[model samples]
Target: MRIKDLFLLLLLFSSLLVNAQQKEIDSLENYYHYSQDAKRMEICLELSALYRNIDPSKGLEFAKEGITLARHFKDLKTEAAILNEMGVLYRKLGELDKAMLYHKDALVIFKSTNDIMGQAYCFSNIASVNIDMGYYEMALEYANRSLELKKKLGDENQIAYSLRIIASIYHESGRYSEALPYYNQAMDYYERLNNKTEKANVMLNKAIASSSLHDDFTPEIVDSLFSQAQIIYERVGSKYGVAAVHFHRADWEVRVENYTAAEQYYLKVLEITKEIDAKVLYLKALEKISEFYEIIGRNQTAYDYLSEYVRLQKELFSESKAKEVASIESRILLREQEQEIDVLEAQQKTRNVIIVMIFVLLIAIVLFLLFFNQRYKEIKRLNNKLNDEVTHRRKSEEKLKESEEQLKVLIEDKNRFLSIISHDLRSPFSGMYGLIYLMEEQYDELSDEKIKEIIDRLSKSSSQINELLEDLLSWANLSSGNIVFKPEIFNATKLINEVVDINTYRLQTKDISCRYDSSTQFIRADYFMVKTVFMNLLTNAIKFSDSNSQIEIEREIIDDRIVFSIIDHGIGMNEDALKKIQQPGKHVSKSGTMGEKGSGVGLLLVYDLLKKHGSQPEFSSSPGEGTTVKFSLPVK
Candidate 1:
């Protein structure tokens, strides 16, 4: 049979398996109420997961019921687990605030109950959400906390998961050097656990990191890594994993300029996503394909794919919200029934006490009345005191939370400054020192040509160092709220040309050309800040480009704003670099295409300056293809 036919057969089998699982769930539901408390909670959790992808409403219903039962039994451990599940559900629905709230709440309960394992899981969940929010600092912090706790617990699978999260955070920050050890550690643990699924995931992650570190690993090793992951995923019948493997492979193919293989792999990803009914992955594949088409200059096809992606993404969000509403209503109704039962039980207990009192009333009615009056007053006094204590405790908790948040901000600032000192300042100065020392040693024997070359290199390094110092000062001034934004009307074309003129020498030195296509659009913004944005972007284009490659700078009026872009067909960046470049104070420098040097802090300054003018920068790149960085400013 053909590959397509085989896929259809496998899909049919998977559907049948799903149906059988549903039947088992139905059987469990029929006898659910008869089961013991512990068994019931287990069953509910199982049913929730089984239904999670099939019907989100049913999944949430089961999860909500499980949470309610866990709380009623005072099962804090189980409740924390269920809350984490609820957070995951909310995250899937794109309700980030609700997801964060639930995870934080779970963390608090876990800490209070001293459930170390639950606390680790809470940390992991928080880290994942923070990663999604692009809060790399917090993500790293939480991932490390989770890893530490898991280490103490000594569970291989849990430890592996924690390690993976930490690796992921490091990788996301473009710190692949820091990430590799964690990846290797996680791989070993997963192998010891014999967890094929997680092993496959780790392999894929390792390959992605390898892609970013061009000098550390060979292309063959990376390809082999991807292949191993693909085999494991396929063997385990993990459609999601298989799709992920394909996507990564596609990315690698693009990097190697194997356009045909990349296109085929991308299509395969879409096919697998569709077969597995994975909407999010399907959407992601569509977007990647759209970008691929754009790369190949098929604008119409790219737009068509993008349009479909946007439509499906919106639909998915709407569907998630609607299901959430239905599940919430179901949960509320179920809780009401539980509450009614509790009320009835309480009423019965009260009646029994009254009857017992009546039976003893004839013997000591007067004595009992005097004692009851005193007891009532005493109970009321204690209740008042308890309420006051609860209020005070709550206030203390709020203050503690505020303090924790402030501490996080402070730590982030310190780390940023430390990065500046450690890398930005040290790297250039260290190079200058070494070069000066070498020149002094070779002064008598060196030829004039060699001396002139060294001087030129030294000049270039000095310029880079000077640029870094200036950017650092600008950033410091901005952070201190001392840099004033003076908005004025300026021609976008004129400003771009000026920036190009300023960087003309850098471009000519590399035998590169700069071209601009801009209308006579005007924008009201801080002129110097805008100019700096263009300068940094243009310089970056020049830095990353190979000799003789052309840079395209364009400005267009889009929706009453001037959209400016600097395009370079040079050594492109990976996703990690893109993420790191966008993050404030977290940028890391890499050597340019022609051994050009940089301080890596320019983008950070540019980002802050753009935000100062109410604009957001955007980046798009694939390795070897090129990069496009753009932002829009309001028209005057």
Candidate 2:
């Protein structure tokens, strides 16, 4: 390749890497430095318009900060101005109650100050709040109020805000006929203002309503809406807007059952969301991905992403942490209230106490007797409760310790039994096999076919005995605490191959075809132990299935673990069988789908091996449809 060609190739590769990412750094920078004062709440308002697309959190943050400062400075005008932004934030946060509280607060202040425009905006907020809370009548009333006020103020541009809220109310209230006109009206107002972002938002909202309400939702309409949203987002340099558009597009993809397309859009959304620190959107995106993966039976992958999302949520909205912060703020407010109350109360108490002292001067003897009895009774009651609690805790601890000791002893005894079975049983089987072979040769009065048949029968019996011995030995080795698992980086693909090979004879006889799929990512696991698990499950699957049945072997990494699933379209058990499988040694042996007999030991060995190696044996099966067994080991 020429040098120019190499440079061009590098550029293409770099573009490919970042093609899905948002590049709105400049817009984000422009938004950060606006003022939030009375004369400049207009600047704050402008920033809200910009921030909704670029970084909504930062927008909310700035708007809320202005609300705090405005309230602190007692500037009703500025405080009232942030109501719209506050509603937007609360709606996105999914806390419709808090959103309602802020909107109503602004309304009360604006109404008291006789600010018609601010009050009108508050009506719009109220309408949106009512819509989310499922109060259609209340929502419609507020929406109409906002429209009337907007017309009176002759603010045609602001009328669009009221129209959008009304449209949402109508959509949610099941009045599609009413909603469509309002949506179009809102879009037209935006067009008049030359506001591309608002126009796109309106169009997108219409698409959502149409798709959600109609069973046969047309793809063309959704595509058109998303295309408009994407262009507007790009035009305004808004990563948050781009993320939102991608997220919606992903939802549409899922509606069409195009999981691959959905995944691509979800990934794009995550990239943009992460870049913009759009945590709320990021959380929602991760959850959507989890659902998609789960639908396709990628449980492990679903689990991993769900775990991360849950972790982030716990970090973000920890009730205990929020309460702690609230407590700190509340305490300051309480202390100030207390100081004021104390001052007033102290003076009143002083006057009342003087009169009480005069009146009590004659009743001191009676009061002393009453105070002494009350104090003694209260202290005794508290002491008794404390003693009872301590005694209860002591008994609970003792029982827990006893249970732990019993479990430890049971595990040790189980390991000892396994060792004995491996050693003692193998010795007798070896001796019996040797004696049978000698007899076969010495007693040659039988024909050649008879001798061959006897030898083969003995060999199959011996092999079954040997397999059992191996399982017990493996279990004992793991239980002995001497099976050091020095994890080496290995291809799960190759490990699965080797496991499938071990089951080849069984599979071929039954006409069961096993399928294996893997990714390039290497998983760190105890290779031998993991391989043993795969071998056991595969063997079980093939054994259970009839001739011409299919067995699928699935493997995937979910977060920090490697999961393997063996699924067979074979003779499956019901819920009762599932219960028996949990405690492996308890189930009776049954013939395979191909008339192959089992030691009933296969499941026992699998359970023991998994228990020893540290993976949970999980399965779900019916009477005849199929069986699936899954096990997962931690990835290093």
Candidate 3:
């Protein structure tokens, strides 16, 4: 525990850490004393990166100074390399536009010098920034540019890096199909190079593509990729990369719905990310945990997760996106102006000689042949590409048309069936009425007591039949899209009372005390549509209640909306029974308490009617306990 002992212990720890980074460190150290200033600048940039975490401000300062020195010494190659390094650091610092500016500047310089490898690196860097910024179109453009440059230069390593950047963009943007080929290419190149670290990075990207597509990620390629990334990350002493590896592993497990393993890996990523101060990685970890909790029906945990997510979102988006976009455009304009000035100078130097050499007939013949061949090839290629696209589009259009026709046929059939059933049912019930009338007329003196009973039976049966017919027609009207939604102001409290009065006999039959504590809020809704919902719900509650059971009706104004609920502690449905409840026109009659038969069309009609006005009943119920059905009415 002595000072010397502590120092030695620290030294030993440092040695262990550097041992992992020794390969990169040694390569950089050797490059430091190289003969050229460009080579020296390359080493300095890497050194700055290695120390970025231990001291960020110093690292940034060192990288900037190296870039300046490279530029001052007229070492364009070194300048381009240093710019890429600065871009990477700026990207880590969350300065996306600044990173892009540096990368683009380097790209222009590299192209001027015909430094193809440098140009490819710059393109990849710019593409990465675009990906993070959600500019997927621009990202793909830069990625393709990088690929072209790398392929022409025949620098396989740079080509691999280009492919990796492209795959990362596609993977991040939820484009699995587009991403797969790029990952495969990157992986192939890394394998050929035997570059363990880069190979692992590419492998992780491939795994990510698979996971995004929801492919089965078992102990095969997924595990292999994760293990490879872990190894290479540890070998390079890159905590950030290590965190990424852990995050990917956790995400892979999440896709397979394995929450426990995902949670463990997320925790590991969190622990390492804290030391590295990687805010983005921390946000990603929080998002993954939130999604996992939601699948298990943990609402409170999901809420907490979303809160953190929204907080991070505000931090990223609420600041200066417009300013950054404008600044980039302004810079592009300035560069174009400079290019115009350069072009004018070149024209001045070549004008006289170019004019003296002009030939008419031979040039015209050459141009004609060139244009003819080019036009033919262009047309052929376009036709070949568009043939399948046109066919697929035609098929999609036909499917849509067929679906519409089927829907129309189904609607017509339902209307016809309703008309037939209602007409037939009415005739039979009407015939019984005629028979009773004839019996009363012919045998008026049969018996006074028997006559009284027959009249009562006639009244009850007629009432029941009328109620059934009303419900069936109401449902039919709503289903055939004949219901009108005319929003008007009405006192909802008074409306409920009116519905209560209309159904008084049904309520009185069950001896149920109907409690109404309506809110004093006037609502803007379709009057008839809202009334239908209230009456149907109240009737159902009364029908299901046992004798002397109290039906509680309540209303409230919450969050600028009218909420009316009928809560009854009666024969509530189990979940299975609730699932069988039909939509409009799907209901069959069922007997209520006191032998009062139900018109199932009432509920189905209510559901359809309420939904037309952008509202529907929500329910909470338990078997033998109760039910609460409420609807939300929009306010003016």
Q: Considering summed lDDT, which 10 consecutive residues are worst modelled in model 1?
A: 1-10
**How many steric clashes between backbone atoms does each model show?**
0, 0, 0
| Models ranked on TM-score | 1, 2, 3
- Local distance difference test scores for all models: 0.76, 0.68, 0.68
After aligning candidate 1 to the native by TM-score, how far in Å is the CA of 132 from where it should be?
A: 3.9
Candidate 1 vs candidate 3: the lDDT winner is 1
Model 3, CA-based lDDT: 0.68
lDDT tens string, model 3, 391-495?
434654574566457556555545544554566456547756875986668676657777777777778778767766676657645653456678998788888
After best superposition, candidate 2 residue 595: deviation in angstroms? 99
Tens digits of per-residue lDDT for model 1, 453-475: 88887887788778887887676
TM-score for candidate 3, residues paired by index? 0.36
Model 2 lDDT, residue 453, Cα = 71
Model 2's lDDT to the true fold? Answer: 0.68
Candidate 2, 489-537: lDDT as tens digits: 7777888888888878888877778877855546667778778778777
> Which portions of model 2 miss their true places by more than 4 Å?
1-119, 125-133, 174-177, 318-636
User: What is the model-wide C-alpha lDDT for candidate 1?
Assistant: 0.76
Instruction: Please give the RMSD to the true structure for each candidate, in Å.
Output: 33.3, 32.0, 29.3
